[model samples]
Structures are given as C-alpha cells and as structure tokens.
Target chain A: MNIFFFHLMPYGDLDLSYTDKYDSAWVTLPNTYFDRSKGTAIYDRYIGELSLADELGFDGICVNEHHQTAYGLMPAPNLIAGALTRTTKKAKIAILGRALPLVNNPVAIAEEFAMLDQMSGGRIITGFVRGIGSEYFASGIDPTLSHARYYEAHELILRAWTEPGPFRYHGRHYSFDYVNIWPRPVQLPHPPVWIPSQGSIETIEWCAAKERKYTYLQTFSPIELAQKNFDAYRACAEKAGYKAQASQLGWAIPTYVAETDEIARRELQPHIEAFFNKFLRFPIEMRMPPGYSSIASTKMLIERKYAVRASQQTIDTLGDLGMCIYGSAKTVREKLLHHQKEMGIGNLIAMLQIATQPAEQTEKSMRLFAAEVAPYLRANASTAVAAE
Target chain B: MADNVTTETVDVRGLKLKVQQAGSGETILFLHGAGGSNWTGLLDRLATKYRVLLPEHPGFGRSQIPDWMMSVGDLALFYLDFMTASKLDNVHLAGHSLGGWLTAEIAIRNTTKLRSVSLLAPAGIAVEEAPFGDVFLWNHEQSTRAQFHDQALAEKRLTVAPDLDIALQNKSAVARLAWNPRFSNPQLPFWLHRIDKPTLLLWGREDRVIPYACHVPYKNGIAQAQMETIDLCGHAIHNEKPAEAAAVIEKFLSGVKA
Candidate 1:
C-alpha cells in the first residue's frame, strides 16, 4: 500500500487545562491562549517534518484547512502545500483541502492550485472538501447553501482549470464573468482530484460515479464506519457500471510506533487523550449546523456516530474502535495490513505528529515507521499476494 | 377561541400557502416572525376587531417554498406579487421579527396598497452598539427561551414545539434568508424613509433577541411613526404580552382608521 503523511499541524503548545474553563477548543475558544513564539516554532518544525517525510520516502504529504480553531493551525492549507514545493521533492503535495463551500471565489483557488501544480512539476493532488459545519459558522456562508455551493464551486474550479477562460461562468451561488486562468495546470485535464471526507454518503456516491471516479479518503473516522462507507462507494460504483478500484480508496488515522506496544501506548497516551478529550470537545450544534446536510444525511450521521461524543472515548476504547493506531512497528504494520486487506484500501495516510507529541519523539516514531513498517507494507502492496 | 379562525390554501407564483384568517373588518395581514405563523393570542384578539389574515410565509407552516424564493428579498417580492394578485386594497400590514422586517420591505417598495404598517421587534436595521442577538447560534431551548421574558412560558412553549417537519422548514427558511449579515439587511435603514404610510413600532423593554435599543433607528427613520415599549417583555411581544400588545396596536389601528 502507498504510505502518505497527513499533518493537522495542531496547536502543540495548547494548555490542555483550557478545558476546565472553556466549552471547546474550536471557534468559541478564546484566541488569547495562543502563544505567538510557540506557534512560530511549531509551524517551522511541522513543515520540517513534512520535508522529513519526503526524505523518508513517503509517496505523498497532506495538509488540510480548519478555521477559528486551535485544533489545526492551517486555515490555509495551500500555503503549507506551497512551502512543501520549495522544501521537498518527489512526494506529492496534497492539500486535503480548501473548504469549497466557504469560499466565494473558486477561480482564485483554481489559480492557486494551478500555480502549485506548476511549482511542484504537476505533483499536486487536488482534494476538495465541503468543510465541516463548524466552518460555516466561521465563514458566515449560509449553511443551507453549503451542499449546493460546494457542488457549484467544484464545477466552477474544474471548469476554470480545463476550459479556456474569459468564459462567462455563472453559478447559483457565485457568478464570474472572466473565467480565464493564466497558468492553467501542469497536469492534463487538471490534476488528480481526491476527496477527504468524514463519511458522508452523498460524498461517496458522487465521488464514486464513473465520470469522476475520484479517490475517496476517509478521515479520522472509525474503521468499521470507513468500511461501511467504502462498501457504499463500491455499491455506487457498481450502479455506475464499474467496480471501484482499491487505488480509489484510502484511510487517514493518527498512528504512533515505538519499541514495544506498552511503551508506544505510554508515550502516546497523554497527547492522544488531550487530542480527543480536550481539543475535540465540540458542541453537537456546531458539528452539524442546521441545513449543513440533507435530512437523510444528518439522520444517518446521528444514527451511526451519535452514541459517543469524541470527549467521552478513552484511549483504549478508541484503539478498540479502530479510530487510532498505536503499537510497536510490527504490531502497527500487522494491524494496518489486516485493515488494508479487509477494507481493500490501497493508500494509508498516517498522522505521525499528533496533539502535543514532542518534536524529537515524533521524529523517532516517524523514522521507525519509515524504516520498518513502510517497507513491509510497500513490499506487500497487494493484499492478494499476502493472502496467498 | 379558534371557532372563527378559518383556514385555506391559496396559490401564489405557482406555490401553495395556507392562510389562517378570521374576523371581518379592515384586513390586517399579520405576518409572523422566524417562529412561523400559528394561531396565537395576538391574531385572535386582533381578529375580534379587524380581519386578521395570517398566511404562512412561503417555506413555513403549510407553504411549500418555490426554488426561486431564496432570500428575504425574494420573500418580500413574493408577498408584493401575492398582494397585487389578490387585489387587496387599503389593507393594514402588520408583522413580527423577520416578518416585521418583511413588512417594512414591502411597504418601502410600494405602500399604495397599504393603509398603515405595524412592525413588532422588526429585524431589518442594524444598530452599531446593541447588535441583534445571534439567533442562528442559539439552539432550540436556548433560542426559544431567549425570545420570551418569562422563562417558564418559554419552557412551556418548547414542550409544544410545532410539527418537526414544519419547524425544520421554518428554521431552514430563516437561516437561508438571514444567515449572513444576520437577520438584518444592510440598506434597510436607508430605505425606511420610503414608508409613507402611518407606521407603528412595538418593542419589548427586555427583548433579548432584538433589544429595545433598536427602536432609535426605527423611530428616527419613519417620520410619521408611533412607537411603544412593553415592559417585562421580549421579542415575542405578540405572544408574551399579547393582550397589552394587541391593545396598543388596536388603539393605533383605530386612530389610523379615523
């Protein structure tokens, strides 16, 4: 399986004790707590880590956007991806991505992505996301228009990339008279499009359609939920008159490796707990803002994922639930290989740096994962080979 | 109490609308707020004197929204078309909250059909110091409670929240219309001068949603406007202090008739 490094670049210096006074680590959380010097250091160090991942031979490096949150520092993941272009070579730069619905100008994004594609020699993997509902609150874009806007923006971006511009592009949500982009894209017919999602069925169906056939990367969801969604994607592909390829499916989860299982657990425990319990202490309304999704989609989400709030889950239960992976390299590889075989995921997006994981320790873990776990998985790319 | 309240579905711009109407005098088209139109005490008391016509705004109650009706601006235009098509003459226009905002929008556009206008805690103008409450951020219990001065009454109302589908439809419509720039049109204050008809502004002294502080702009904008403040009341002045609010409106409407 292809290994990619995913970075949230969270506020690593967060005084986790903020949970005592504040309701969440997201939008409403006061920005007074953000330390400037610490922020600058972590940002530089995080980019260094992405470059390190490239040197370590990961196939791709990913960054994503979130607004008004201490959770992920990159409100503009494109900037980080751009920085990667100068610092790293060979590895694909995946901006996993810009919130399509929140932006009024899709053409600007088209130009940026095109420029990045050119800069990286066409190594850009365009990932479009409808951004989480909490983002709608931050952007002040109508939540009711989210789904419609996302689709329209996606169409507009695709058009701007492929078609010769100064073209009149009118969308329900956005209207543009001049649609010409200068750089266009280094990749033909536009760069490869990937979708990083939180297991929305509508997303799966749309991405799995024959015309699109975009890679669908399930992000930070439980493995069972990922499997169910992947199966749904396959079902959609079948309806669209083709079987979905393993290459079109991927999984992103926070992972840690050490000398032994116990040592790995001990090392990751505080950071993982703080990550889930404190940083992800979000309100239900903010998470699923009204009109953010269709009634069916919201109902499905509530039914499938509502029982346990992110704050409620302990580290052990989270591992049991297949949300995060942590162990010795051998254990990590075996579990990942098993899931890859079972779910037929050809890509594994490992988040090596987590909430408050020290720089040295993160490097050590990444090095171990790169040296030991990555080679085994790369050699045994096809699960069918291992099965025999 | 509901015996005189008659219901009918009317077609406008190829969309269906359920109108709850009663009494028989000067037509008072009472538009409801973001809360959706219901058989409330304000309508009933007013219905006893003037003919109170309460139609669900498109996308609320029994009204199925047309794809074209996206924002409050569209809603305002739709109402103007409905009024013109129905051939209503010298009618008194009254509205609450978002509906109140719509009432002003309609009047400012063309007041030839309107004899007078009444706005209860209207949500059209933005005041700098006392910004309107962020209703979008408030959840069911918190938002509902914030609307009334009496927390007990608010809780009681919550137990009987309207049908799930209609309530959701209403909430969605409100969110779509007033989500950004949040419940107030930026240019509404500038256009308030166009209201040539007699205007009545009823505000709650303790309206947590749209505070009493908003009255300054509304009063200053409409030259021939009568303003009143209901003590110990909130945004839902029509429901919270229905009789008192109705009495003030009744007195104003009577003087307008004179």
Candidate 2:
C-alpha cells in the first residue's frame, strides 16, 4: 500500500485546561487563546516533519484546508503545496484539498494548481472538496448552494485546465465571459484528482463516474461505517461499468507507532482525545448547517446520531472502535493491513501528527513507522498486485 | 374555532400545492411562515367571519416544489397564479413571518387584487439596528421556546416530534429562498410604498425570533399601514395568544375600505 504522511498542523500549544470554556475549537472558538510565537514554531516543526517524510522515501505528503478552526491551521493548502514543491523531492504533494465552493473563482484555483503541477514536475494531486459545513459560515457562502456550487466549480476548474483559453462560459452559479487560464497543468488532461469524503453517495458516484480516486476519511466513526461506505463506492464503480482498482480507493486515519503498544497508546491517546473531543467539538447546527446535507444523509445522520456520538466519544472508545490506529510497528502494520483488507483501500494516508502532540515525539513516531512498518505494507501490496 | 376545514391540492405551473380552506364569506388568503402550514386557532377564529384560504407554499407541507422555485419572488408570482387559478379577486391577504414577507411582495406587485393586507412579524424589511434572530441556528427546543411567550405553550407545541422528511423539506426550501439575504430582501423597503391597500402590522412585544422593533420600518414604508404590538407574546403571535392576535386581525380586516 502507498503510505502518505498527513499533517493537520494544529496549534500545538493550546491551553487544554480552558477547553471547557468554549463549545468547540472551531468557528466560534476565541482566537485570544492562540499564541503567535508558538504557532510559528509549530508551523516550522510541521513543515520539517513533512520534509522528513519526503526524505524518508514516503510515497506522498498530504495537506488539507480548514477555515476559522484550530483543527487544522492551513486555510490555503495550495500555499503549503507550493512551498513543498520547492522543498520536497520525489513525494507527491497531495493537496487534499482546496474547498471548491468556498472560492468565488474556480479558474484561479485552476491557474494555481497548474502552476504547482508545473513547478513540482507533475507531482501534484489536486483534491477538490465542498468543504465542511462550518467553512460555509466562515467564507459567508450559502450552505444550501454548496452542492450546486461545488459541482459547477469542479467543472469550471477542469475546463480551465483542459479546454483552450478564451472560451466563454456561463453557469448558474458562475458566468465568465472569457475563460482562459495561463500555464495549464503539465499532466495531460490536468493533474490526477482525489476526493476525500465521509461517504456521501452522491460524492461517491460523482468520483467513480469521473474515475477519480475516492479517499474515505475516518472522521471519528467506527470501522464498519467506513467499510460500508467503501462497499458503496465499489458498488457505484461497478454500476458505472468499471472494476475499481485498489489504487482508486484510499483510507485516511490517524496513526502512531512506537517501540511498544503501551508506549504508542500512552503517547497518542491524550492528543487523539483532545483532537476529537475538543478540536472537532462543533455543535450539530454549526457542523451541518440547514440544507448543507442531502435529505437522505440528514435523515441518516439523525438516525445514526453521528454528531452526538462524535462529541461524546472518549479516547478508549475511539481506539476500540478503530477510529485511530496506534501501537508498536508490528501491531500498527497488522491493524493497517486489516483495514486494507476489510475496507479494500489501496492507499493509506497516515495522520502521524495531531493536536498538541510535541514535535519531537511526533517525529520519533514517524521515523519508527517509516523504518519498521512501511516496507512490509509496501511489499504485501506489490505481491498482491503481482498475484492479481 | 371552526371545525369543518377542508384540505385540497391545487396545481399551478405544473406544481402541486396543498391548500386548506374553511368558512364561506369574503375570501381571506392566509400565508404561513417558514415553520410550514398549520390549521391554527387564529385561522379558526378568522374563519368564523370570512373564508380562510391557507395554501402551503411550494416546498412546504405536501407541496411539490418546482426546481426553479428558488426565491421568495418566485413564491410571490406563484401565489398570484394561485389567485388566478382560484378565480379570486379583491381578497384580503394575511401572512405571518416568511408568509408575511411573501404577502408584502404580492401586495407590492398586485395592489388592486388585494383589498387589504395584514403582516404578522413580517420578515422582508431589512432592519440594520434590530436584526432578525437566527432560528435556523437554534436547536428544536430553543427555536420552539423562542416562538412563544409561555414555556408551557412552547412545550405543548413541541410535544410532537418533528418528522425528519417534512422538517428537512421546509428547511431546504427556506434556505433556498432566504439563506443569503437572511430572511429579508434588501430592496423590499424601497418597494413597500407600492402596497397601496390598507396594511396592518402586528408584532409580539416579547418576540425573540424577529425583533419587535422591525414593526417601525413596515409601518413607515406602507402609506396606510398601522402598527400594534400584542403584550406577553412572541414571534408566533397567533400561537401564543390566539384570541388577542385574531381580534386585532379581525378588527383590521373589518376596517377595509370597499
């Protein structure tokens, strides 16, 4: 399996004691708690870790975008991707991704991604997202128009990358008299597209139809949920008349490895708990605004009580539910392999760095995993491919 | 309270809408707010004096929402077609909250067709000083509580669990129409002068949802409009003190010039 290093780049110096004072570390969280000097140090350390991952022969390094949230500080993943292009070598700079609907001009995204692709020598994978519901409030975009805007923006960006410039375009959400983007993407027909979703069927079908890679995000949910979603994606691909290859499906989850299972758990549990319980503690109304989700998904969410469970989840329960993977190298490898087999995911995006995790400890975990875990997983994946 | 209310489906522009009607005198076209249509005590009270017509706005309660019905203006036109389809003329228009906004829009466009207009906590006028409360952001309990003056009434109103399908349908419809400008049309204050008919602005003094102070803009904008505030009431004025709200509406409608 292809192993990628995912960094959330959270503000690592948060006063954990004051977490109870706010409803969440998201949209409504007071910025007075954020320390600038510590933030600069964290950013430097986070970038250093990503660079280290590239140097250690990881297949890819991932960055994502979130707004007005301490969950992940990178509001513009493209900037980080641009920076990574010059600093890192041989690793795919996976911007997973830019929130399409939040942006007013999709061509600008097309131009920027194309520039990154060229600069990185075709090592960029562009991931288009509708963004989480809170982003709509942050960017002041109507949540109801999110789906329409996202699809339209995706189409506009794709056309800007592929179609010859100076073409007039008219869409419901966007109307540009002149559609032209300079420095079109180096990869033929644009750079490879990846979609990181929590299993919205519409998104699954859309991605499968377009033949883009579908990355299942383990957003503090049980393994069964991810498996069910993966099954749905595969079914969607089948209905679209294509057998989904292992490479077409991916799983993104938090993972940490140490010399022993106890050490890994001890090192990871508090941070994981803080990340989910504190950082991701947005209320249901804030997280999924009115009309943000489809009727079916909304009903499903209510029935499943997904938000309630996510908010109340404890560290022990999350580990038991396989929402997070942490242990010694052998244990981590086995657990990851189990997920790969169970979920049929070919790519594994490992979030090695998380909330309030010390930079040195995070790097050590990453180094240990790289040395002892990645080779076995890579070998197994190639063998499985060769056998096929 | 009227007991013989009949519900029927009306088709306009190839979309189906559920309409409730009762009594049989001069027509009183009733428009419901964002909360969806209901056969309330106020409607029953109004029915005693005149015919009450309550058509569920497209995208609310048993109405087939046309894909193109994306704005309150579309709804205003739909209601005009509704008036045409129903073959009614010189009807008195009464609207509450979102419905009030729609009523104002209709009156602005077709002042002659509407004999008089009654707006209860109307939501179209943008008030910079007293912005409307965000009911969409509140939980069911918070929203329900905000709608009434008495906690017991709020509890009673919320006893029935909201059906997910209906709630989602109503929310999506509301979001499509009002999420951006946030329950108010910016140009509405400019156009309010076109509502030439006698207008009544009723507000609940204790309204937590739409601020009571918004009554001034409506009263100022409409030439023949008069304002009244019901004490110990909330945004859902009719639901809170049905008799008082209904009495005010009845008195206003009684004063409509022939």
Candidate 3:
C-alpha cells in the first residue's frame, strides 16, 4: 500500500485555555496564535521526516493548505511542496491543494505545478480545491459561485496543462486572450491529479468520472463513516463503468503512537482535545456557510444527524469517535489495518500533533511508525504481527 | 485599559449587547468589522484620547444573537440607538471594513449626531474593473498574502488568535445576512450622496481584499467626502498599518471642529 504522512505543523505554544474541554473544542483556539518560530522549527523537523520517508521507501509525502485557524499552520502547502521537490529525489511531492477559486490566475498554478514536476522530473501531484466554507469567509469569495468558479478554473488549468500551444480560455469566472504555460509538466498531460474531499458527493462522483485518485480526508470521522464514504465512491465508480482501485482511495486521520495505549491516550488526548475545544467550537451555522458547497454535504452534518451539536463530551470524544488514532503501535496498527481491510484504503495520511510534545517525541513517534508498522504491512497483510 | 471603560450589557430589542467603553474626551464610538471583538489592536489606539466605546455588533463577539437584526443597515440603526441611550452627542465615528459601511449608513440617517466620520477601508463601494480579493477564501497564508507586504511579518503579527469562537460566530452571521449577494449591497451606492457629514475616505492602496478601485465610486458619489490614500496597506488598514492609519485619522479629525 502506498502511504503518505501529513502534518499541520501547529504553532508550539501551550495556550489552550478557553475551550469546552470536551465538545466544540476545535472551534475555540484560532490557528493565528501559533508561535511562528516554534512552528518553523517543527516544520523543518517534520519536513525532514517526510524526506526521510522517501529514504525509508514510502510512495509519497503530503502537505496541504489551511488558513487563519490553528488546526493547520500551512497556508501555502505549495511553497513547502516546492521546497520538498528540491530536497527529495524519490518521493512524490503531493501539494494536496492549491485552492483554485481563491487564486486569481489558474495559469500561475499550471506554471508552478509544471515547474515542480520538471524540477522533480515528474514527481508532483496537484490537488485542486473549492476551499472549504471557512476559507470562503476568510478570503471573502462569494459562496454562491464557488462551484461554478472551481469547475471553470479547474477546466482552464487542465486545458493549460494539456493543450500544446497558446489558446484562449473564456469562462464565467476567468478569461484570458492567450493561455500559455511555459515549461509544460514533466509528466505528459500534467502531473497526476489527486482530489481531496470531505466526502462531498459532487467531488466523489467527479473523481469517479475522471478516473482520478481521491482521498477522503477523514478529518472528524470514525472508521464506519470512512468505510461508508469508500463504499459510496466504489458505487460511484461502478456506476461510471470503472473498477475503483485501492490506490484511488486515500485516508488521513490524526494519529499518535506510543509504548502503551495509556501513555498514547494520556499524551495525545489533551492536545487533540485542546485542538478540538479551542478551535472546533463553531456552531454549524457558520461552518456550513451557504453556497460554500452543494447543500448536500453541509445539510448532512447540520440538520440531518445533529452532529454539529455544541457539547464538551462531543468535542472531546470527536477524534476518538472516528478520525483520531491513539494507542500502542500494535493497537494503532490493528486499528489502521481494520480500516484498510474494510475499505480497501491504500493510502493512509497520519497526523502527529500531541500538545506541548517535545520535537524528539514527535520524531520518535514518526520513527516508530516508519520502522515497525509501515514495513511489516508493506511486505504482506496476511503475516501476523505481535501487538505486545 | 481605563477604569470606567466597563463592559455593559444592554437589552437592545431583547438581545444583550456587549459594549466596551473607555477614556474621557469627545464621544468617539467605534464600530468593528465582521468577526471583530472590542479588544482588537485597532481599538487600543483609539481608546487613548477619546471616550472610546467599542461595541461588538449583534451576532458577533460576545453579544447575544439578535433574531430581529437582518442586515448591516439594521446594525447601523441599533448602534444609533446605543449612542442615543448613552447620550453620546457630537459623535466622531470611526469604522473598519463592514464597520465603515455601517458608519456610512448611520451618517446618512443621523447626520446631526456625527461630528466627523472617518472610514478606514470602507466596503460599500462597487467596482467592476478589478475585483476585490475574496477575504473569505483566504487561508492564513493567502489572507496575509492578499493583505500584507511582507509574509513573515504578517505571519508573526497574526498570533494564532486565542479564541476563534467569535470569528466563527461572526462569520456565520455575516454569511447568513450577506451570502445571497456576497456582502455587496447593490442599493448602497444610491444612499452615499445623502451623507452630509465631513467624511474621510481613507483607503489602503494595496488593499486587494476590497480592491483600491472602490474609492472611485465613493469619490464620485459622496459630495462632502475627501479622500486620503495610505500606501503599503490592505483591507485591515487600522490593524495592518495602525500608525499610518491613526495618522490619517488624526489629520481628518483635526480638520473638523468638534
């Protein structure tokens, strides 16, 4: 199975105070309060690990973009991806996105991605996003036309990447007399397109139609829902007359591995809970801003399931409920394998942010995951490993 | 922070309003932008000379969500009520972003109450040439990139806010009220001519979030307004370049006889 490790490289400050300790925790602490110096140091350390993953023989290293909020410090994952392209020889530098509509020119994306692909000799994976609803409010994009603009911008960018000569792209959101991208991508027909989704139906169906690889960024979900989403995608792929490959599905969840479940639980719980209580406290009303996505995705969590309810228990246990993994290596491996076997997930993106952890410990967790869990599974899924 | 600058809870049409009052000079009441709290850095500067009153708009900050408040105009009128109840006459109004828009709305209706109106990167003007960078779509990087000259500095200044609860709440409320037309009120330009108070149209030249071209419409529309452009600044002029922004405000305020 091809795997990638991603980190938000949160600002390293011990300031998780005004949160509900249990539910709506993620909405309280803003990402803007992260210590830049510490954030950079952590970024350098983890980015080095991402590079080491290449030496350890992982398929790819993932970095993504988020803004304002402290959940993730990466506002421009592309810049980091660009830097990684220069350092790592073997691993693919997957910029899990450049929020397309937020960008003024898709050609710049075409140019940048092509440059990275050329510089890395075809090791770039570009992910395009409509950017989630919070982003729309942060950047002030009209939510009403988000989908339209995303589709148009994506079409323009794809055309710029594929078509040989300067052509014109006249669309609703973007228009240019001549669309010429210099240094066409090293990979013919552009770098491999990876689409990251929060299980939006349109995104799933779109990826299915195009035969593109998709990752269900299992942010706040549990194994059951993750499996359901994969099932949905498989069904969508089948309906589109194509068999969905395991490589086409990627899963990411916040993970912390330690010597014992108790230790892992003790250390990781507070940080994850702090992240939740401080940053995740938003009522559903703001989170699902109108025209942000198709009404389906937002309504599912808001009016339908009562998932966005404000509560301490709900916030604290959210990660444990579905999306977070905290345990001994054996326990974590078992849980990860459960999801893999159930959903046929080939790509697993692990997040390692446990509050106030020394960089050495975080690196220790990464090293353990790399040395023990990864190699064993890579060789054969049938082999029984000690959970001891 | 002053002693009398107390947080008062007022029952405005059944909603509890959080108003931060400080200092003792002229009655200079401040209105905050979308998602802004009274404690934001900009208000700290204004609190020095004037009896600065920073009220978190309804459905924002710690203020109770008003079910009746429907639009930015509703917020403007509510603020007017707040001033009247406090007996704050000869008001020197200063606002940023949506607050600036609300200030313009208030000046048009209750011109007699305002001593002078200073708008910092106001948002009511419409420009068709170069579109404003969408403030909502920006992640921290894109947001700072759109607003600041230096990425590192902007990142440094943007201490991951302690609590985004207010931001989230404000975003939802703003989205609820303005998402239909995307915060650009089409009818607002028609009302600008009615504002007779001495208006200072302060603009940040590098403001991509609300494109600098927006100043053109205001210049053409408002008869009594004068313009001053601040260089190397963006939409959050007061927050991004406060010294320069405050300098512009001081000049504008000094020009008026309060």
Candidate 4:
C-alpha cells in the first residue's frame, strides 16, 4: 500500500506565444524550442517538495531514464537516485530502471549499481529495462537483437555481481576474456531486480523464471490490458511452482490527487496530451524493431486489439486510457483497492508529475495524496506494507 | 557506367530491383541507409574490388513499396528471399544505420548467407549515458546544431531547403514503412546475441546522432564483433568520412577470406 512518486522532468513554459495555437501546434518540435533553463530550478523545487513526502511519511521515491528528448531529463536515473540517497534518509530510492543491455561494460553497471545499493544501505530497488524504441535509434544498436542482448547483458551483470568474477564469459552475444569485477555488491545476490515493462509475454516469462520483481510500465495501456498482463504473470509464476507475491509485480501509473476526479482530470488533460504527443510518439519500426519482439508480437501489434487500439488513439485518449489516475482521496483509494483486488499488483508507482501542469497544482496534488489517500491504504495494508 | 561495369534491372523474387554488378572476386551485397538509392557513393567504392550488388530496397528510389510488406523484419526477411532468388551464398554484407541494423537482423536469423557482416554507425543496441539523436525531430538548423562539430558543414547538410518537399516525400515514404517509435522496441532490447556472424562495428567518435561509446552494448552483446572508431564523423560515417569508413570495411573484409 506504499505510494511512490515519479517525474519525467517535463519542460514547461508559461508564456504562450501569440502564434502558439495550442490545437494546431506540431508537437514533434524539440523541447529546447521552449525555455529549459528553469528545469534545474523546477527539479530542485520538485525534489524539495517530494522530499517532504518522506517526512510526510510517504513510502518511496522513484526516478527513471530517457535521453536526447526533454521528456525525462534523467538520462542517468541512477545519478538522481544517488542524489536522493544523500538528500533523504529513509525513503527507498527506486531507480525504476537502467536500460541494462544498452550499457557496454556491464561490469561498470554492476559496480555502479552495487555502489548505489551500498550508498543507500541496501535501500536500492533496481529496475532493469531494455530501454525503449527511440533508444535503438539513439544507441546505434539494432532493435532486432534487443531481447537477446538484454537477457544476455542482464545475465552478465548479475554474474559480475554474484559470481566471484575473473571468470571468462563465452556468451552467444557478449564475451570477455576476463570476468573479474571489483566492489562486489553488499547484497547477497545484488539488490532486487525490479522489472517494469508493458508486460511483454517474453519479459513476463523471463521474470517469472528468474523470480525477479516485475512491474508493468504500461502507463498508456488500458486497465483490461494491465489486468490481462498481471494475470498472465501470476499464471506463469504459479505454473513455475511459486505463489506470486504482491511485492513481485507493480504498476507505473500517472496519478493526480484533487478535491474531486473531475477537477483533477480537467486540470491534467492538456499537459497530459502535450507530454504524450511531444515525447512519447513512436515510429512503427522503432516500436517493433526487428527481432526485439517476435513475428507473433509484430502480427499482434498490427492486428490485435491492443496493438491497433494503441496505435490509432491520439496521445490524449491514450493517456486517459493508459496513463493517469485523477480523483478525490476516496476515489483514489477505491481505484487502488480495486486494482489490488482485481489485478493483485501490490506496488503503486505514482507519477507525481501528472502532466506538465502548473507547479503549484502538481505540488498540491502530491500534498493532498500524501495527506489524504496514503493513510487509508497504509492502514488497510494486507501485504508487507513497507516502501520499496 | 564504366566499360567493365554493368548495371541491370534484375528480378529477385517478386522484387524488381536495379543493381550495379561488377568485379569478379567474393560477392558483397551493399544495403543503403535511409533516403538512399542503390548507386550510393559508398557502394561505388566497394564495387571496384568485389562482385558488388547494390539493390534498391522496396520504397527507396525507384523501388515500389510492396503491398505485402509491413515491418522492418519483413524487409529483413526479404533480403534473405532476395539472396535465395539471386542464388547467391556466402556473401559479405555491409549496411549503414538502418541498413546496417537490418543487415544484423537478417544475419542473426541466417548467418549461413553471410561471409561476414560490417555495420557502419549501425542502429540496434541500446546504450545509456549516450543515446542516438532523434533524426525525426531535427529541422535544418536544429539538425545542424545537434549533429556536426563544424557549423559550416552542418549548415550545408542541414539546409534541405529547396529540396525540402522532395526530402519530406522521401522521409514520409520511409516513415510509412518504418516509423515506429524511436527506432526501438518498446518492449525489449535482446536480439543482438542471436547473431552468429563475425561482425565489424565502425563508429564515428563525434557521432552526435549515435555516439562512439554507444558501441559498448553491441560489444557486450555480440560475441564476435570487433569495433573501430573513426574521427570527424556523425551518424552518417559513410557520407561524412567515406575513405576511412571504407578502409575500415576493407580491413575487416581482408581479415576474413572474403
């Protein structure tokens, strides 16, 4: 029942130019076209505000990674997590992920992540990602080989941490003559590997097999899709001979707390639309990159309900359907409880940056959620209700 | 065309392709980058040494976009289909960016067709700290500002001005076929290991679109890849520094029997 706040660190400019026609503006332009100097100040303010979340007794703090685009300035989310470790004492620093395979020398990853774990005193909940489509275009790595590369890289990184290295690895994808790593992790097998995905069946199967933490980062996915995915994971976990724990699966959802759902939705929609259209647009090639997913997935993306529905919907509708949760404290609680009952996901990863709405509004939403809704859930906590 | 060189329109499966064929050594198939035609200047250099065949990919210059085609995987598979139809086996394949990535994809699925593979600033592996620049969002000024180290060259390359419409048309055609999200898989990035080919990765040290350090993920994931970094280049290494890139290719090719 712990609530964690997430931010993509969106660029916001209050001034709307005379020519700035909201509806007709092509969202594909660079975010730098808008003033970005305030990002540092705003992030500092955001950090300060969310820091109070820990003081206010909220569970954990979360940060993530994206590059080049202004969607999320956290190209190195671990850096932010590292800062948070120094800033706050108790709240868990959830680096929702590092794009595991995108890193060349995973030993560095092992070293860095282990350092983060130690710095935080074992409070690091590591989320591993293959990154996303734009990453393929950005990294010069073929998307076709993403899945295998990710798995292999993850294995290498894990081994670097756990195995008394200097062991040569002759993997199909990655090979090294020497496998010795310094600064082996303090945690027995490395900090928990939290995987937040769109619930790709391959990812679900992989996570289940490894018994790692799996969270669905399908903010744009529908409730039904989330349910289906969580169900599949549970089924896979059960078939693999283990009863699934709520801590094992999570959902990264956009959330805004207000006096009422109507107020929250109305205030959040425009910024939500702007964020989605500008930063989240995916090209078809990048979306399915060759061999990143299977032919069946490619076919499903083109033919299935989820895929067709995902592609056709504009950013606004998609966000409404997939991204945020906007409501009164009671409504928020009800929805969360419902998600828990229906989907069985224990972790509730909330987007504190719910649409690049005004700073005051965002702060207000966080304060209200922390003050009102969080207590109700904590009181009714059925699972081990500590902040991850 | 040169006296010894011959260009012909050849049928490889259902694809009607214009190919430049020359030389008499090992066969090398050249795949062009986005917005490129078969007779790219880089391909011309390769044609002198090997029996090089540069086929116009469907939806590229003069090649019709096929009805059955959908994803890049389809395009990748079609290359294999093209090889089968051409009765070519054990050919060295070289591709740049999108083409290089597609080459890797095809080689991963069927390494038997390739003598070896070379990727010049190839796009596929995901790298943190450094990521490939977004080509879709770049306008002339922004693209220039974002990419090249030298501003004068950036200005020249950035100004698609007079030919903006044609450039847009070409880009749109590619988008119609390949535009997904950021040239990535939203789900996973793990297929690079599936490749069994002896791969050569060439990168530009100053590539703003995709960085030299970005080669780390590929180096980690592809067991047989040997990497080389070139200077004074961006994403388009073959275009910006062709001689160095081509020399790297030649060395990689020479190291192998092909």
Which residue ranges in model 4 land beyond 4 Å of their true spot? Answer: A14-31, A34-36, A210-218, A285-288, A299-322, A381-388, B1-258
What tier of docking accuracy does candidate 2 attain?
A: medium
The local lDDT score (0 to 100) that residue A114 gets in candidate 4 is 85
Give the per-residue lDDT digits (tens) of candidate 1, residues B1-258. Answer: 479899887777677778889999999998899988878998889988988889888777645556676778888888888887777889999999999999998988889899999999999887888888877667678888999998989989988845656666777778888888888888888888999999999999999888889888889999889999899998899889999999999999999989
Lowest summed lDDT across 10 adjacent residues in model 2 chain B is found at: B61-70
lDDT of 2 by residue, A1-388 (tens): 7889998888777777666687777777888888876776777788899999999889999999999988888998888888899889999999988899998888899999999999999999888889998887688787888998999999899889889988988999888999988788899877988888877777777777745545544444578878887788778877888777777777888888988999988888889988887787776777778779977877777676655664467668888888899999999988887778777677888999978888778988899889988998887765554212
DockQ of each: 0.58, 0.67, 0.06, 0.04
Q: B150 in model 2: Cα distance from truth in Å?
A: 1.9
Residue B255 alpha-carbon offset, candidate 4, angstroms: 33
Model 1 interface CAPRI class: medium
Order of quality (TM-score): 1, 2, 3, 4
DockQ value for model 1? 0.58
Kept native contacts, as fractions per model, are: 0.49, 0.71, 0.06, 0.00
Model with the higher TM-score, candidate 2 or 4: 2
TM-score of each predicted structure versus truth? 0.96, 0.95, 0.61, 0.61
Off by over 4 Å in 3: A18-40, A210-220, A295-297, A304-310, A313-320, A354-356, A382-388, B1-258
lDDT of 3 by residue, A24-107 (tens): 223334445555557666678767767776776667888778766655667888778877887788987888878888777888
lDDT at B207, model 3? 82
**RMSD vs true structure, all candidates:** 2.0, 2.2, 14.1, 12.9
On lDDT, the stronger of 2 and 4 is: 2
Scanning candidate 2 chain A in windows of ten residues, the lowest lDDT window is: A211-220
> Pairs clashing in candidate 2?
none
Q: Sorted on DockQ, highest at the top, how do the candidates line up?
A: 2, 1, 3, 4
